[model samples]
Target: MDYLQYAFFRNAVIGILIISVAAAMIGTYIITRRMVSITGGITHACFGGLGLGYYLGISPVFMAAVFAVTSSMGVEWIASRYRIREDSAIAVIWSLGMALGILFVFLTPGYVPELNGFLFGNILTIGTSDLWAFAAYTVVLVTFFALFRRTIIACAFDSDFAQVSGLPVRFINYAMTVLVAVCIVLTIRLVGIMLLLSMVTVPVLIAETWSRRFISIMLAAIVISIVSSLGGLLVATIIDVPCSAIIVLLQVALYFVARIGKDISLKRPIR
Candidate 1:
């Protein structure tokens, strides 16, 4: 609780919550639609955005957002039309993006200290500006999701049928890609690029087994993520562990408990 007294700590907490809500909401669709790998791909590609930001000396978040969206679109275009497997295409793009990011960083003035921060995240270092940016982005994401719920649900459950019904499947897919890009970019400040995948996947994984309805899953995911965020902050504060790592650990523990509960409930007693 004392840790929360610091202004930056407070901002960090708010930033993390913003990230959790966005990740949880979009994560539901990502997991249900089997786009988990793409989440990672988009995350790694944000490194290229980091590099671009370094080169341009602008906010990395801005460059990351641009790179993530462009990369997602590129992956979508290739996956939609080419014979290449989605996984293969993702891997190819992921590698190329990272390579370019490294080149850009190395070419910059001095060794970038923020590079490592972007890799693993440094939530405790969040600033007021970051908090505001996160809040604004979250609003945009929520509005996007709310307005496109029907189309997204249809496409997620059945793309071929959505296309047959003239639901603008391709456009919706691209829009989802943009949302994911936003999600990835939003997270870099809170969880970093390397471990952002956990925030995107863990809550959704727990909710999937516990809830059957979409709204229920999303609500559960949000609750789980918020709890994990608080727990992670406490654990990191007391133990001096990295905030992002603690967050992932808390999510893992929750997943195990959920799994264990399921196993116990499914067990049969001797007759």
Candidate 2:
């Protein structure tokens, strides 16, 4: 409890809250749009970005963003040009990107212990630069989401209708990819590439059970994310546990509780 008053804990809470909100908002569309698998492909591709950073001895964040955006664009290009199933395309990107990433890292000079952070994250070690970049990305994501709110709803509800109404479905889809890429880059350093999907999906799962409206669900997800972040950090500080695991565990617990409640409600008799 005492550590809650500390500046580092406070910043961790804020950063994670922003993460939850951003991921949940994008995740809603991701799940509804059946893009979860594609998102997974991009997550793996982000390893290329991490490898690029290591090879150039530069900031991983910047390198990750570049690789993510490029990979996302490549996916978009392929999906548009061929009449192939997205799953196959995603599979191709997933395997090749990861293989290339590993190759690049193997070729890079020197032994860098921090490389593991890309795979498993180093949440406790987040410094000022990470926090600032997170805040900037959060603002940008929120702004984009807000501006395209109606169109996104339309696309989610009925892509045919959205397209008929003159909304650029392909462009919006591309935008969504870019958004996910940005989040992937921002969060890989905090939650790692391996555990990133949990952070993105768990909060949204809880919110979907409890919320009636899209806005409410997104807001609820943000709150859940914040609570988990704080709880995880507090536990880590007090008992020296892994913060990322603690945070994810907390989300899993909340998800089960919400699922159980839903099941119970469905079984109850209504007047």
Candidate 3:
């Protein structure tokens, strides 16, 4: 309780909550569209931006965002226009981005003290700017979903049908690719690149066991993410462990618990 007096702790709590909401909403879309691998690619690509930012003495998050968005858009464009397979494109981009990051980091002078934070995350370092960014992103995501829920759903479930039905499938796909990239970049501060994919997917997986409907899963995921993130943060603080790892481990534990409950319910006789 006394730790609540610290501004950094308060900022972390707020940042986690905001990030959990936005990640759950966007993660629902990512999972529904089966773009989980693409999301992972984009997150890895951000490492290139982070390394570049460090080499250039600029904001790593901004650089990471740029790399992420570019990588996502590049994958979409290459897969749609060129003869390359989507998975191949993702693989190329993933490897290229990681290679670029390593090269940049190797070339960069000085000790690069913040590199560990970007790789593993330290939630206690979340700042006011991060909170503001998360809040703004949440607002934009909520508004987008509210305005185009049906179209987004149609595109997610069946893009061919969505295009045939004249629902701007191309536009929606591109926009969503960009949105997912941004979401990954934002969440890097919470769980770092190594564990971010799990952060986005675990809650969604748990939510899926409880509901098949998209909206219901999104809501459930939000609640689950909040609980896991907050609980992990608190436990990490008490035990003096890494917050990001604790958060991810907690989510993984909950996923197994959800899986067991789901199995038990399926085996139970109906009344």
Candidate 4:
């Protein structure tokens, strides 16, 4: 295809694959540990970083990473030290980040271009530089998953048990929180802040209908995300529609199909 000759097309493919893998891993942890809203809180918080980056004329990605990590850590600190509800902490951070972002973006002199791209996303605009950054981060994420698979699983299922077993529960939480923040920032460019949460959540939900094992769900989610995302990208190119929305829709459709399949299996007679 003529599109393949274009660097942007190649970059989009590479970027989506890397993101799918990273998101599947992070999504597993988030779902297992019930941190979906925390990740969502981090997503909204990254918008402030984008506004701050525009205000300061620096890389939006860098500022977003900072906001994400801070938001995540802040939530942890508030909930643990002050005995506040985690959801309440998330609410505070979420509002503050969005408010600060709006303030900074307004304070800047010119009309901000590329802001919408960060908000709604444009997969077609991804470049080699984006791909490289995603690749580096994915490598680190994979290494983390590989090294701490058992410990991470322990923490996810029961932090109390893990702590009592002499595992560094607190340290693992902080590390995973940092990793989750970084994943959120990197994924922002893919689906933007608006739809990014689904990219991390939907595929895992689809996988859960049929599998109960942690690694099984993660691996199945990675495959489902890749298939749906790539399929959506190709369809978007063909129809001239938004890729991210299409991708999410496809994953959601798969979720329904998986649910139906599960129901059907339950009604079948045992051999």
Which candidate number maximizes lDDT? 4
What is candidate 4's lDDT per residue for 1-271, written digit by digit as tens?
A: 7888998898899899999999999999999999899988999999899999999999988999999999999998998899988899999999999999999999988899999999989988888888988999999999998999999999999999999999988888999999999999999899999999999999999998889899999999999999999999999999999999999999999999999999999999999
Better of 1 and 3 by lDDT: 3
Q: What is the Cα-based lDDT of residue 133 in candidate 1?
A: 78
Candidate 3, residues 1-271, lDDT tens digits: the string is: 8999999999999999999998998889988988889988898899899989999989988999999999999999999999687788999999999999999999899788988888888889999988999999889989988998999999999999999888999998998888899999989888889999999999999999889999999999999999999999999999999999999899999999999998999999999
Q: Which 10-residue span in candidate 2 carries the lowest summed lDDT?
A: 1-10
Model 4 TM-score, all chains together: 0.97
Q: Model 1, 95-188: lDDT tens per residue?
A: 9889989889988887687888889989878888777877887898788778888888888888999999989899889988888888788788
Ranking by TM-score: 3, 4, 1, 2
Worst 10 residues of 3 by lDDT: 79-88
User: What's the lDDT for residue 65 in model 4?
Assistant: 93
What's the C-alpha lDDT at position 255 in model 4?
A: 94
Instruction: Output the worst ten-in-a-row residue range by lDDT, candidate 4.
Output: 123-132
Q: Mark the regions of model 1 whose C-alpha exceeds 4 Å error after superposition.
A: 268-271
TM-score of 3: 0.98
TM-score of each: 0.94, 0.93, 0.98, 0.97
lDDT of 2 by residue, 1-271 (tens): 6766877666777677767678778777776677788888989988887787888889777887887898888887887799676778888888877998898899998896887777887775667777888888888888987898888877876878899999988888888889888988888867888888888888888888977677787778877887887787677767887778888998999999999999999999999
**lDDT of model 4, residue 93:** 97
User: Per the 3 Å backbone cut-off, how many clashing residue pairs does candidate 2 have?
Assistant: 0
Model 3 RMSD in Å is: 1.0
Give the whole-model CA lDDT for all candidates, comma-separated: 0.87, 0.81, 0.92, 0.94
